[model samples]
Target: MGRTNLYIHYDAVTNHVMTRAINFEIQDFPKHYFPQNIILAESTLDFGRFDPQTNFKLIRGASEIQVYFESAHKEKMRISNWIDFETLEDMHGLTAQEIAEILYLFHANKALKSAFFYKLQNNYVYLTLPNGLNKVYYRHVQHFYPRFQRAMVVHMSELLNESRSLFFMRKAKVQALPLEIAEQVAPIFVNGLKVNFQQAYVKGSRHFVPLDIVEDELTLLTLDQAPKNHIGFIIYDSNAEKWSLELTLDRD
Candidate 1:
């Protein structure tokens, strides 16, 4: 995960919604009553719209259970947007104002320290812990789906390199670079391994970088297989001009 976000879960038994301020791993599930065989089912609308009437299935041992969501009786619900009472009544027992307050809490919890709020999906599966299994009672299964179209935003004017080492940059692209205008945006790194920008052509937008002025030194690494010792990144714009940096590490 690039930048981690807080995840929210709804507890039907308790009629409460809980959230995690950090990225949770597969191992963390056991304490929350998630079995090793519990496979997180990703929503069909993983990165798209959500249908309230979608059906989900859970397999426990030799038995299979089906899950469904009751319609909110409204058009749609969005993150951070004001929710009507009908939607809240359908999902949880909270009122519109209470739901709004909970939304505020989501942001507030994220703002604590350097934590950030991750994306929220309409579909989340709740799993109850078996008796004598672990400490917690249950957990909500959030998506493990990778996001493809992410907005890359950066505010730093200059890139920096190691204190005393050569910097290499790989996987660079430009939007519409021409021979004449290429010089204007050519000071940046390119897709292949190279110390300097000699010439660049636009095969796609991902391999593009607009380093009009050389202010800093950045070593772009090659994203090759087998732990090749190179870091890779692509620049895409949602025109939001805001960038987020997320760090994910494997845990034992």
Candidate 2:
């Protein structure tokens, strides 16, 4: 025989309970499997007692639940469940404080301003400044293996002024390299390459050189690559201390 311990929290507003349990058993037994007997027993509870005055019927018992082992030596497991209710009004009231805190944080952070804009499109987010438009696209590329790509940028009017002269330049930057060689050697490229700007630029030419070409051009003037991409596009602005970047994709 094995020993087991369980802890449960009741949310009267949500009309549901969450439980966490720990158990010990011999090595031969499957480690964290919930026996059918326990589930069947729990199904018999009078869930309707948790709420009244509502017509909501508890058709199924704990249909959506997750259980996982937390520790092997201590034989700990965690379980979560979402009970269906007649109306979410009670649950909403219970979590209102937590929801308000999240909203407050979003307003305080500049990064979150673009959160609303990102939802306007399926996989693209657009940020508009006085001078130019920054567009972000969600893409996936394959080299040796599959990988996802996302981009964000601060477009400067000064750079656009010289767009025609730099439009045909070719250059490559190390985005990702073969896993084995990536550590030692970075990606390199030659000049005069033609590339498209993922972000839409209205005032300037539609096309711009690859970022690598821009870096090489700056290095020729400044005498070195700024060591990273961020430093290469610095511009002065009045509305905000720094330019805002928009998110191209929301993670799955």
Candidate 3:
């Protein structure tokens, strides 16, 4: 979730969708810090039919709009493992112009200072209901998409601190998130720190460090609240040889 770079690709001709990610382990006390998306995953993620109810299910600040849509499960907020922005275009069959207009009207207002979608590679792609996952709305992501892909951007430490979706920085100020928002995250530690969501603990990261800090520069990533609980994580790792799911819990 910290300093993670997310890459999305949709082959318009072949109808293939891909999302690549490299997430940082906060326990490493990474020199850099960045924002974390509302993380989710599921198998056989579908590209169509995401029913978004902007009312009751809407979670501000911490949650993104895509999390409110329907995924594989019937639950309103249940999203499949992977996501693409095509559901809006597919479900309503709205033209690019209409969809753009709607978004503009909803977002382009006085109450909101500024609203923009972010994609890693393309910083200037004209995404008009961009088909599938190619449109995370970072804008211009498509312009450099080809370049970044060809190079295979594995590390994102060179990026500026402000444009942080996933990138590294030298020192950042850590902030505490509210309890309700903090508990939702199950943190991973690279140095073999055990985390259990079942326990009573506070968990949140210094998401998006602001520039112009006069205080001490952060060396290790700090959680707003570290939890004291017991819940094991099962992580699936894959390579050319074989795929493995790490960890097994002795349950209650």
Candidate 4:
């Protein structure tokens, strides 16, 4: 998950829309959702164009869900561009404007000590958090979906490391690393912990990292007898072809 975005979910049964300010995983839109967006773009002729983004019907309901397009407000909405952003919306009843205002002011005034809005750069507002962590947000285009004040945005930068570290390391298990490799590749180890402790044993410059070690009883085998993907298949000297493993699985 490179950079996350907030997602909006719609219920097709009653044409309801909702949004939450959480880091959303990026996924390919359903095959059917694409054409609905295209129709939205072509149908709305004059004035504000429909936003292909923002919302989609999550439930299939044994039938194709209709994608909705409408001018949220007769007038366009705009807010100071954000350094950390995602749009919140008002649908048939959701209060997006109130939420956006509250959040804008909340961060802009530095209401919270740990995280708050910091400064402005011409047309953009920057929110600063602890560490070197930061992301930039944009107002998207002029298109609007349902009802929204603005589309929040984030800047993709090396600072994502700061985000992963800050967000995931809470109550984290600590481990000391070599000083030389700290800044160079420390983050890689933390990312799935794919480090190869047996790199020295591999021939040449090849560094073979064990994918995942299933916590199971050890099994014994020689290097030649090892399967394509194996764990606990004991091995030591490749020159002498010495290896063994012991696997004990109990089924009752």
The TM-score values for the models, in the order shown, are: 0.19, 0.17, 0.18, 0.17
State how far residue 61 of model 4 sits from its true place (Å).
18
Model 4, range 174-222, lDDT digits (tens) per residue?
Answer: 2222233223322221121211122213444222223222111112111
Q: Which ten residues in a row have the lowest lDDT in candidate 3?
A: 206-215
Q: Which candidate, 3 or 4, has the higher lDDT? A: 3
lDDT of 2 by residue, 99-122 (tens): 343233233321222222111111
What is the TM-score (0 to 1) of candidate 3?
0.18
Comparing 2 with 3 on TM-score, the higher-scoring candidate is: 3
Q: In terms of TM-score, which candidate is strongest?
A: 1
lDDT of each: 0.23, 0.23, 0.25, 0.24
lDDT of 3 by residue, 94-116 (tens): 44554354345233321121222
The per-residue C-alpha lDDT of model 4 at residue 148 equals 21
